[model samples]
Target: MTDETDQKDQAVEKEAEEKFPIGGCAGAHAEFRKGNFGTFVMRAQPVPNIVPPPPIAAKPLPPNDEIYAVCAKKEIGDRRGKSFPLMRRWDDGKLRPWDIFIARFGKQYFAYENACPHSGQRLDWEKNNFYEPNYMKVLMCGKHGAQFDVETGVCISGPCEGQRLTSILCFVDDDGDVCLTGINIDLDADVEPVKVVDPNSDEVLENNGFKLQSTKREFFK
Candidate 1:
């Protein structure tokens, strides 16, 4: 009877080992009994690592005396306008700030200094607000009710009638960038905040007057 009982106990032990294998639930419980509670606890699956994409780089600024891109062509729609702040180095080696606006009339684009011909004040009363409330046919000055022709910068009806806004030579480049050309300006110059003068200011007026006189002389000759 003792030999039969020993054989039965050995058979039960072998069955338990086969059912739970080594390092499985039954083996984990045995390790737990040996003061290793962590071995008996369930573990989560390993997670994979994820990497993010790189960022896009911005376009580099052009050098001085070259064509400097004012803004993208798509930014201004037909009959719409936008303003930009620029720095120009003068002949005297002084850097001055310039407020300029670009307006589109049909497929043509025109650019001018933001200063009004009547007064030296900027055309916009509010920031970037350069047009009339409901009428965009003309560029209106916000300080006083002054309207100017979109094609020609000539003041049509205002205090400074017959006076024109100082125009800058600009055209659309191959890259669809509205660029300023034939103008001597330093794009990298650090400009100081000084009052912007009108085109009729003493030295500027004299220079412009001389150019008009020269053109008249050449036209007749």
Candidate 2:
């Protein structure tokens, strides 16, 4: 009688395994056998293969002489400005981090170093705020209230009067992209903030005064 009962139990287990071959909860298999198909069907389905997507490739850097797009032309409105942090090669032949800004006046766009001619401080009292609040006609230095002409970058008022902000050669390309050209820039360099140079210092004056060219040439209007 005991041998018959053991054989019966073995037959029932083999039947359950055959019907629910995925092998999950025994209680669920029992429920499946009882015709409770809702939860059992979900557990019995095979899992699908999950393939991960490929990594995206980085864009190659352009040659040092070629033009590089800094931002879109639509980003800067008329009488507005935008600032950017970048790495530039100074006269010392070392790559140094620097801040630059682009301003739009009427139909023309101008680009200049964000450093003030006085005290070597950044021009914005507020982050990315480079204009005088009253008229919005000039670039005001947040550090010392120095005002610079939007088109020429010449300091018209404040302690740095008669001085000029270092201009960067840039233009809006045919694609409507604002680009920096005719300059030695390292867009791919790891620009550490701690390495930024003092804009009013002699090193900056020598490098920027004689070496850097103004963007007064013909450009997209």
Candidate 3:
């Protein structure tokens, strides 16, 4: 080959080497040359995983069980339930938050903690919405599809099968209203209902049957 032709070829080769380095065109990302574009394109990289935030823990209650409040005795029909968020006083005397749910199965009345034993998360998928569309017969966890017995709070199916939910003792007052009587919970102070938002829309949604004004809070099982 002629000397000028050889020099031109060598310069072109050096330019390609400098432009698209050995491993990649830009730094460490492995790149390949696009024949049509005549440019180096980066290889596909995996996206980093993101973990969801944990559920909010319930407030601790005092040592002795206290009669916090009285709830009305409403017929627990299909998709019927209620949530009562109360601040509990622990041994340290700091106030903590815990919620209770009252649901009905058949002719029996029952009250349970609003948390799922399997995931340590709340039971309702939406705000106080725990029914499975089968007349609210089974209480399903909103997170992992864990099913529970409405009357017993025992896990019937799902990851937490054979596990029992935290139960709270409720009494039927003489006026036929349900009274709150449970472990270490005292509901004598002002309590605010937690506003729930739809993860998809990011807008605040109605809390099923939970009402802010009424003394009776109603929701699905």
Pull out the clashing pairs in model 1: none
Per-residue C-alpha lDDT of model 3 across residues 1-221, encoded as one tens digit per residue: 69999998788666656766564545323333333344443444567798889976644643465564456676445457667786667766666666878776654667888888986877766565666544567887766777888778899988889998888887677787777765775566666554443334532222233322212223322
How far in Å is the alpha carbon of 205 misplaced in model 3?
Answer: 15
Most TM-score-accurate candidate: 3
Clashing pairs in 3: 59-96, 59-97, 79-220, 80-219, 80-220, 81-219
Q: For candidate 1, lDDT tens digit of each residue in 106-143? A: 77888988899888767754445566546578887766
The full ranking of all candidates by lDDT, starting with the best, is: 2, 1, 3
- Error in Å for residue 53 of model 1: 66
Cα lDDT of model 2 by residue, 1-221, tens digit: 99999998888667656665465577676777788763442234667898989975443233367787999999888888888878777655577666788888877888998889888876665445688767889998765678899888899988889999989887888999899876677889876652333443332111212332212211111
Off by over 4 Å in 2: 1-64, 90-93, 194-221
Candidate 3: where is the Cα deviation over 4 Å? 1-65, 75-79, 192-221
Candidate 1 lDDT score at position 88: 64
- Tell me the TM-score of model 3: 0.58
Residue 74, model 2, lDDT: 94
Q: How does residue 9 of candidate 3 score in lDDT?
A: 79
